[model samples]
Target: MNIDIYSPDAYTTGIPHEQFKWLRDNDPIHWHAHPEGGGYWVVSRHADVITVSRDFKTFSAEQGFVLVDDLPGDILDMARNQLLGMDPPKHSPLRRAVITRFTSRRLEQLEPAIREIARGMMETARNIGEVNFVESLAGDLPTAVIGSLLDIPRDMWPQMRRWSDLQTSASDPDLGGTPEEVNNASIEMGTYGFQLACERKDSGADDLISLLINQEVEGESVSEAEFASLFVQIAVAGNETTRGLISSGMYELIQRPELYRQLEQNPDLIPGAVEEMLRWTCPLHYFRRTATADAEIAGQAIAQGDKVVMLYSAANFDERVFDNPMEFNIHRDSNPHLAFGHGIHLCLGANLARLEARIFLEEFFREFGGIELTGEPAFIRSNMVHGFKQMPVRLLPR
Candidate 1:
């Protein structure tokens, strides 16, 4: 079957289960032409994606920076500085420097504060009676949490969110801006981050920004440009991906009231429930890696420099790996989902994202007895990011 899987339009109809099912069965490693030009091999099986993710030498994130479409020069340079784009040796040190901040213990300590943030967000929604959960509710948690981490001013959080939204939604005509507009936004955000770093240079603020600014790596302090890139990395990555999780998790629960009610009754199940949500609606559909050399994946020859997309969404539902693959079950044990990715480039903020989701849901169901969809939920028009762009819901306050 000829399928235009790369199109943004395909994602609006939701996960292309039919096409993926065919690929998983007939061609676990399938090649498809890109509409824009060139082509990529889509790796659908869970194990294959894991192999590609782990064997970074063969499939290099640094080679192409993990997006199917070739990015503009500025964006490409920005991506190279991110942990996601850095290859070994370099990737390890940078990721290690920031890893301690997002440990399970640190996230646990932040849970109560996150709970407070959730309550405040819910209170704002309750006062309004009804609000767009995407904007008023789900969107704020990531930005606030990330801003608090980076020492960015609360007033600046909204602008940070705007920049992140634009950066990730480059495919959506309605949401995306011109290359120049995007570049300007990045520069603005980066400049703001630099100023904050300079302020914290000697003031000794106990925050991630300060830690990064004060600490030295490889016996040398990080450069202003490197710091700016790291700043953008934490700000945008933490904001957009987790925001997608919260919004998509809610949309899924509201649609599956049985699952929603189950969670409401047994709040203890939320942690597992959150995992299932991540697996079921893996926010990032796929992340591309370029072949470093001529390689073979599942018998398909991939030429050097060819793009290979690890379809996390498809892999999460791989029939061979997941029992009852399509079903959204909160109790699914041994999930092994790649929502935050895997291997050396695994998400540095994975624990934080999970903590935010768990606390947000716990607080959500505790305060509001029931959540009902008041209007259609809108999906972001992009292949890379998957989640609701607009989710209208009524919170039935307990």
Candidate 2:
């Protein structure tokens, strides 16, 4: 097969599952050349992805940062501060500090507020009748939830969303700006976060921002600069990925009316359906790691400093792990999808994303009697971010 996964255009219409399947079957550890320079190894099998994720000592997230594209020296320095891009000894303390706030107990306390946000957004969508589900409906809830968590002014939520979009959707003309603009958005966003950390540090406030800026783990506290990078990752990640989950998940349901009604009739089944959504419409396609030492993945010899990318979308459908992996079955007894990734670097907001998705579905079913696509959905033009950019739909009010 002529491999074109490197081009964002390959994913413009939809996921290239055929290519992924071919690669997984024939070359589980296939090496494909990057447009920018040399080649990198692509890990497509579920077990190998897990192996690479678990053995972070040999496959370092910090060496090259998490992105497949190499960043400039200064940008790499900024990215190293993010929890996703840090290795053990240094990764543990910061992760512990942030994990405290996202524990199950904390998420339980947060459920009511997230439900209200989802409820309000759904009601407004019902009132509008026809809307772009991605923007007017799905996107706002994440921004609101994260904004409320950090106590950011409501007025700034849209700006943060824009900045986050620019950073993640840089390959899309409609969604992202030029390279210079993208850099500016990241800088401006980090500056704003730094300002918040400075103001909230030692303030004894109860919001998430205060919790992060003031709390210490292993006798070390988060510096303002550190918090800035953390803030960018948290805010941008929460908004972009969660929005994709809700919107793309809904799009999938809209395609299958029977499943939609099944979910609507039994709202209790929404959690299971959410897991299928994460697997089927996985928000991220891949994340890269650099090898610290020569290693082997599925018998493929990898040299030190080689870039290895775990294809989450492909691994989610690996036949060895998931039965009838292509089918969107919500009743799978054991669905171990790598949508939130695996091992220590798993998504910090995993539970929060689940809570938001479940609540959004429940509230959406409550507020709207039925929903149908009014126009063809258009996906974002990016290889990394797999989601609909615009989904026009009419919501029939309950």
Provide the TM-score for each candidate, comma-separated: 0.96, 0.99
Colliding pairs, model 2:
none
The models' CA-based lDDT, in order, is 0.85, 0.92
Poorly placed runs, candidate 1 (over 4 Å): none
Per-candidate Cα RMSD to the true structure, in Å, reads: 1.5, 0.8
| Candidate 2 structure quality by residue, lDDT tens digits, 1-398 | 89879899999888899999999999999999998789999999999999999998999999999889988787788889999999999999999999999999999999999999888888777778999999998898999999999999999999999999998999998999988898889889999999999999899999999999998888889999999999999999899889999999998888888999999999878999999999998899999999999999989999999999999999999999999998988777799999999999999998999999998888888888898889999999998999998999998997
Residues 21-140, candidate 1: write the lDDT tens digits: 888888888888987777889999999999899999999998789888887787788778777888987877677678866777877788887888888988888888788898888888
The backbone clash count of each candidate, in order, is 0, 0
